[model samples]
Target: MDYLPLAQALADQLHADGIPEHIASLFRRVPRHAFLPDVMWGDGRTRYDRAEDPDGWMRAAYSDQPLTTQVDDGAEGGPGIATSSSSAPSVMARMLTAARIEPGHRVMEIGTGTGYHAALLCELVGDIRVTTIEIDQEVADRAHSALIAEDYAPELVTADAEKLASIGDGRHHRIIATCQVAEIPEAWLVQLHARGRLITPWAPTPGAPAGVLAVLEDCGGDVQGRFEGSLAFMWARGQRRGGHMVPDVDAVPDRITHADGDPRTLLDGETGLLMSLLVPGWAHGMAMEPGASEPHVWAVSTRCGSWARMHPDGRVEQFGPRRLAEEFAGALTWWRGEGRPTVDDFGLTVTADGCRSVWLREPRAELWTLHAADHDDADDVG
Candidate 1:
């Protein structure tokens, strides 16, 4: 079972993805399988065991896809929700490139999921300059063992990433987070060296599995940056969105109205991105019942427990204090009026007071403010 060729093939894929040859070469240097556990979950939650199928596992280890390494936070006989994973090599490469790692720069990784990324950091900046943190004790311990076994030791800490200042003594040249956070912790900004860069996935609300990558650079007193691409990572532990009850359509509706536009289009691409920013603390998705003709689009407001459901015929049913569906429709209208800006045109500015403002095109064109973590309400217009 020669794995070098597979490693080379993965490197080739990374190179094709615009990764520099030197960084792509690191893929060839660091064997991904060395950091993986015996069991891994693939697409559709299909479990693969190295012991049972060595060749298949090897192939999957080199595949350009995320492998779920921890389910339900490593609990037994629980729902198979992916709690952690080895991010696709391409994603790691892109984020590493965004961080722009240098030879002597101190790097801090927020989520050391599989230790593979830590190994790459070690290769770039040496073991002494890298510090990786993971919230789950079990996950951290496993990553630590894997890293040590491979003789690539970095400072591995088992604690919540929210407590960044307490874990390390000094500021770092670069900081990267493996998990998505709704709010960028102020400590991350404060713990950065002058002109330091922090790369992480940022979602509009808690518990979102997918979000745009934030490539922020620290200014003298604030950290500001723009969204680049989308990344799907598990939410930060303390900020994970909890379970919410769905609104019953059978009950007497609080309001019945017609949607401003096609409800399905509200949560797609640029429109979806705008809606997330405009209507914070709301989760939306589309679902189709078995044998149904068309899917139903739904939105639920986490701030007020308001819910809205729209059928295929443009009819909307709302049952709560806030009109989430109406708000989403209004957001879509506003987006169109603004010439439909792409996610790339968006930027974020976090001031010294821990306030986050999402701007359009430029920092001065601030659209709205993202509420602090302690605030129970959703964001409001600036």
Candidate 2:
């Protein structure tokens, strides 16, 4: 396939999306094909036009981009599930931009998915000082092989990234994670030098549209930083332990709410807008599944059960049994009570012992402080 044109097109798209010049140049410089394997390619008969090869899927390995190397590799269903892959180009660009890497900066990366990101780091900073860890042995080996093939190798380790302190001197200037993390892994905080910056996709807050880009500051104790932007990524492997079972909303009868008149109006009108405003971080809207030929209905999972709800307006009654809709609604109510401030109004303070998220109204004024443990399983902001 014609690779250069594909790379140019990808770059153009990134530029159009408001990516900075230097970051876009990095994409232009890295060859994506070097990172992908031949088996990952689609049938040669497929058209290579822009529509088909948008973002250079045909030349995924050659362009300075990320590709999905494996899907559902560890799950019971085999490879049908996208368990892992190289991150997307624009996503990588945004992440790298968030990292704000500088020359001679000591960098540690978690989740060496395809070694694609590692290669980019190697390009930006010499390989000698860059370290990356992957939890999957097979994936790590493949990434190592790819890096060796490209003759640009960095320190690749096949171990749990949660134990980051074992490598190096435990003093990295920058720490980045491509995978989604439920909590700020303690090892990262231990490894980062004072004033070091750590960037990662934090676990999604219930009813939020996307994960927050956690920018951590290593203070020689705990790490602290405010959210930079919205990011979504696959949860870290170890973090995905439990099966997503629906919650029993019926247990809390008092939380349920009902309205009169057109059901769709309640589901789609002010309630919807208010819900979005309240749970700005949630990925989907509240859905009411009317029972077949019956007034009884259930509120199903929205955005893949990222949020749940129970609303009934005569014609339809919906409730979530396995979801956190009630909790989401409560959070929304809390936000409303606080005047519905934008996300910018929120601030975070993390120490080695624990972390606290606060909503700030003005300089030196206290609003609310939510405590988040370093290893809490709850998907709230931490």
Candidate 3:
């Protein structure tokens, strides 16, 4: 249970991972083992373990990483799933980098899973300037007690972070959410100070693998931004339900045309990356589940009655009882024509009431908007 050596090794790993010097120093100083629970799982063993054990808890605590503590809590069968967790160190670092936190800056963080990130923030900036919110009361209380034990306390609010504007006085310099949002919540944009940055994982369309990191800018009243990187996170509270049912491909219409294309090419291609770069709004890439035995496939809800299947030999088959295959084909065609830009090509612009993402290309400059005041309306632009 040697803590110092564990911390030193974690610091070394983070440095090698490109974490900044000042931030790495903060990791070095923080007592990560103190933030974890006394009885925890490690190396396949579930028991009362010492937090400072180098090959045990300390490795997980100090490494720029995430660890799962709970799955489905309060579900029909005890904890239903690993619905929430402490984020990975590298992922948190990427988020902090995207957040661009500065000394003395007022920061608000959503989804205080294990309070590890909050502790990191408290170490980076004094606790007074940091505010963290969590929805689960039990989790929040646990995090609160853990932070208190380490003497690194920040304002921990047991509430939904999407409603941050209700608890905070005014705007904050930076706002970050570890949870994935289907769309940018308006409360976030409204509570952000001018020029402030909001970073969150934008959930993928219905059946996509992971979400995208959206970096938004707050102008007077509007907030605008684009996807920066690919990330996989648990869906935010509101988006975590009702969509787990498997889609029925056979129930769809059969108006789609079988075309010749590489299935692996479509799955592993740069189409999604390019679309996000060229088109400012949310974009996705999907393939049909290969066969009953092959589990890869592409289908868009917009073409609910249709689906496209990629074969092992670089061939594509579009079949369904309905005929939205044209739309699917067109969308794919459009994505291919757009030069396949990556997430870095998008930029954000914010205004007093809303935000917009504009593609910097010529002729047909594409744009998408989200409005802050109309967030509750679901369809409001930011």
- Give each model's clash number: 0, 29, 44
**1-382: candidate 1 lDDT, tens digit per residue:** 7899999999998898789988898999999999898999887777889999999999999998899999898899998889999998888999999898888999999999999999999998899999998989999888988998999989998878786665456689999999888778877777788999999988877633248989998889689998886766888887776665555545456888876566666776756666786666777766664576988777777777788788777778888888887787777677778898777788788877777888888888877776565444645664
* Candidate 3 structure quality by residue, lDDT tens digits, 1-382: 5778877777777778888877766667877777676545432333335544546655666655556666675355763356667776768877887788888898989888778889989888789989898999888988998888888789998887666565457678898898887656667777788788888877433334455787877755766666676787877886664343233545453443455654434434355433333322222343355354545455433323335554455445455543223444454576556664565655545455443334433212444443455432222121
lDDT of 2 by residue, 103-126 (tens): 889899899877878988888888
Off by over 4 Å in 2: 39-67, 204-209, 241-245, 248-255, 259-308, 311-340, 356-382
TM-score of every model versus the real structure = 0.92, 0.73, 0.79
User: Best candidate, TM-score-wise?
Assistant: 1
User: Which of the two, 1 or 3, has more lDDT?
Assistant: 1
Error of 1 at 317 (Å): 1.3
What lDDT score is found at residue 82 in candidate 3?
Answer: 65
Quick one: ranking by lDDT, best first? 1, 3, 2
Worst 10 residues of 2 by lDDT: 373-382
Candidate 2 accuracy as lDDT? 0.61
Best model per lDDT: 1
Number of clashes found in candidate 1: 0
TM-score, structure 3 vs. true: 0.79
